[model samples]
Target: MKIQVLSSLALVLALLSQGCVSSKKYKDLEASYTQLQEKSRELNQKYQSGQQDLSGSSSRVKSLEEQIASEKANVAALQAALDKCLNSSSQGNVNISKLVDEINTSNKYIQHLVNTKNKSDSLNVVLTNNLTRSLSREEMRDVDVQVLKGVVYISLSDNMLYKSGSYEISDVAGQTLAKIAKIIKDYQGYDVLIEGNTDNVPISQTNIRNNWDLSALRASSVVQALQNTYSVDPKRLTAGGRGEYNPVAGNDSEAGKMKNRRTQIIITPKLDQFMDLIGKAPEKATKAE
Candidate 1:
């Protein structure tokens, strides 16, 4: 665009020197310049948007790591203090009031963790209900939406997501994922894991080494769709394969094998809020605040 603009200006200067510029040619140059500017703006905007997403993801992961470190430090400090309290008591030099206060503080910290866990659990319930309401009866038949251990799991049959021995997502699965993406965007702080599961059947596909390769590829395919097509955060998304293991049912029966061959999308909200409280528990400044 700059080259084109410079070339246009040079042409105009040359024409002006020769006193032979035409109104039509000048107007054409102006229109071309306008279009170039618009294109440049659009490209710049896209570049900035991509940078923002990258920055946001990196910062979030970094913050989570810091919180984990802080939480560990807090836990260690609490343990040391508790041990000191016990030692003092054993020596018959106990301060009953201080001990009681410390025990009460420990109980409060434990309750805080429990409350945060309950909040995640409640979120799973809401997510499950929302998924139940979103999927149609036919769609539900192809997938099972459940909440377990504060995570939302959406299990889809391999047949729905791919052809026999293939890792590509089918059109039906793509549509279902699109719907899921809408729900994902509406929520926040979720770490999603796409796990591909396979049955005990041996694979003869030359491209795929074994069930492991096929399953991992399938999980990766879904992750790509969610990240590229649906704009899910790359940092929050994980892809994995559980090949011929962790089956929901027995592999001896065809029905059971069919159930085993599936993709499960698990969404768990980040425990950052809880971690923050725990991380500051041993801090004097935090206590004062």
Candidate 2:
């Protein structure tokens, strides 16, 4: 009976040992499952962050492309404007060069004309001196002649030319006028300008109202006399009156007033070169053949 009790106790101890082993295995499996769940949560979070980063990068790339396109358009517009400016500047420079050349040519022509005028003026002075030397002493005393500023100036006092405030020429003045007309006719291609001057005096006659009328009438009379007697071309002659103006001396004394009452006959060469320089020559008129 004692032997049977011992065997029963040994069987109970073996069963308790098997229960402890089973409990230990179950605890280990629960710990491993918890660690695996934490690892899965961390991996999910990393994947979401990567997706956000990729979305931000795409947006930045789109913005950069838009900026680049805008810059490219601006650059093209600027380039076209620059090209236009360059072309206009080049054309302007060419026009300036052409204008400079024309101006230079015109200046050269003007200089040549001025030199010729000087030479002509010198010759006229010599001719006037010769004429004065050849004149009789009485004639020289009656009439005064001088060359000034490339023009011949003659002074005929009231006693020589006309009575007080009279427009009629005296016999002596007529002879002098004839001599001057002969000289003018001999000088071809010369323009004649007759200017009448009067002193500051009032005149109220039946035929003359004021100094201007008297002066104008006197100039006109001289012009008519030259045209009728010498056959001077009307186109080559000009007459003007400067009454009480352009006085040579002050009108304060009798001598000064006498000096102021005078007529001037000016002769000048045709201004061909000067007119050409200033582009005043008439353009060729188109005539039908």
Candidate 3:
């Protein structure tokens, strides 16, 4: 009976040992499961953070693309402006060159006219014939005339037009002026300048003060005769006076003084083309004298 009780105690001890081992194993499994759950939470947090970072990166990339397109458009606009500037500059140069050529051609024509006057002896007979036929009978008179630099200058001496220091136009001079007006009217494009020259002798008349006044009045009187009597265009006419300043001969001799007292009517070709050329050239500032 004592042997049987010992065996039963041994069996109970074995069973108790197995139960303790099973409890220890279950605690170990629970700890392992908690660790796995913690690892899963960390992974999920990392994935969400990564998604946020990727979204921010995508927005930055789109903004950079827009900026690049804007810059390209700006570059294209600048290039177009540059091209337009170049074309305008080139056209301007071409226009300037063409204008210069026109001026050169006009200058040559003017020079030809000047050279024709230098051979006046051969041309005088023809010119006088033309003038006599073109003018009225009363305008025919023996007057001293000169041709220089394409200009026909008739010296209406004091004896022909007025008494000494007088501003009155003589009866004969009036007839001659009428004829000249008719000829000038026929030539529409000619630019006319009436210049009066006076002797060196000073005058103190009531109507006139000095040589300047006398010269100016004479020029004005002639211009008025052309304008009022002949109906010449005012725009095509200019009047100037040289008071003993532009003398033809020395003032010492009586004959020289007589030659110096004169009036000149200058006629020239239109200079519109020449003036256009001058305007197109670069501006040169002139200092005050």
Candidate 4:
């Protein structure tokens, strides 16, 4: 518009120089030129202002775009964290379930062990009672019946079980052995151990070399009598001897020597039963993953 205005002013000036118009027309044309110039100045001012406003608007748009990108990144990071938390919660629930199962299994195994111990104790108590009830008052004077740690021990004096200073079985001992054999036969699952203990006195018998030999022979003799004479199972019997080592009393006096010379019949459940119970136990629990 400025260029068009300047071209029109130049045309008017050239016409005036040639006197193509009167003074009044030239004056009118000059007035139009002045108004056009003023309008051009106003348009230039508005254009400058618009350029400044456009530059500021572009900067604001760039800043807003950057802010939007940053917000998107923050949202992505939060989503990742949420997903990780959800996965961890699921794993934790599974671990808790496994731990509960392990605890339940352990409790069941412990209860089974407790029940087995109770049954063993009951059996031992019944065996002890039967032996005590079967013995006469005179026989009880030389016999001792006891239950220790789920095993039955019936101790008989050496004088009552064997001939004096010898490993031979006495005639009077047959009745007591028969009664004991009957009780042992009743418990088919139990094993009997005949253990002989002698006083510190040395033996001078023909075949016996020392107290160890005497004590061992005494235990063997009793074991043979139970097996052969009374029909007791030899497989259920084990004979052992303590020369003077397992004495119940000191052998310093005759009374202490008499107390120390004795035979013990120990009755217990078969070892295989206990081993089977142990073998059937559950495996150890693993830590939950």
lDDT, candidates in the order shown = 0.74, 0.64, 0.61, 0.78
Q: TM-score each candidate.
A: 0.63, 0.55, 0.49, 0.63
Superposition error at 213 for model 3 (Å): 0.9
Angstrom error at residue 80, model 1: 19
Instruction: State which candidate, 2 or 4, has the greater lDDT.
Output: 4
How do the residues 71-176 of candidate 1 rate in per-residue lDDT, one tens digit apiece?
Answer: 5566567667767767674634455456556555655554455555556656666666676667765686898776554567789888888976789878888778
Per-residue CA lDDT of candidate 3, range 9-118, in tens?
55546656777546665555556555666676667656754564454345534544554465455545555554565567555666655555544444443343233333
lDDT of 2 by residue, 1-289 (tens): 3344445445445656677546565555445555656666667656754564454345534544554465455545555554565567555666655544444444444444345445765556555655554455566555666554445665656567666668877667777777777777777666888888899988779888888888878888788888987688777788888888889999999988888898777776656733543453212111100
Pairs of residues at least 3 apart in sequence or in different chains that clash in candidate 4: none
Error of 4 at 27 (Å): 99
Off by over 4 Å in 1: 1-95, 271-289
Error of 4 at 171 (Å): 0.7
Candidate that scores best on lDDT: 4
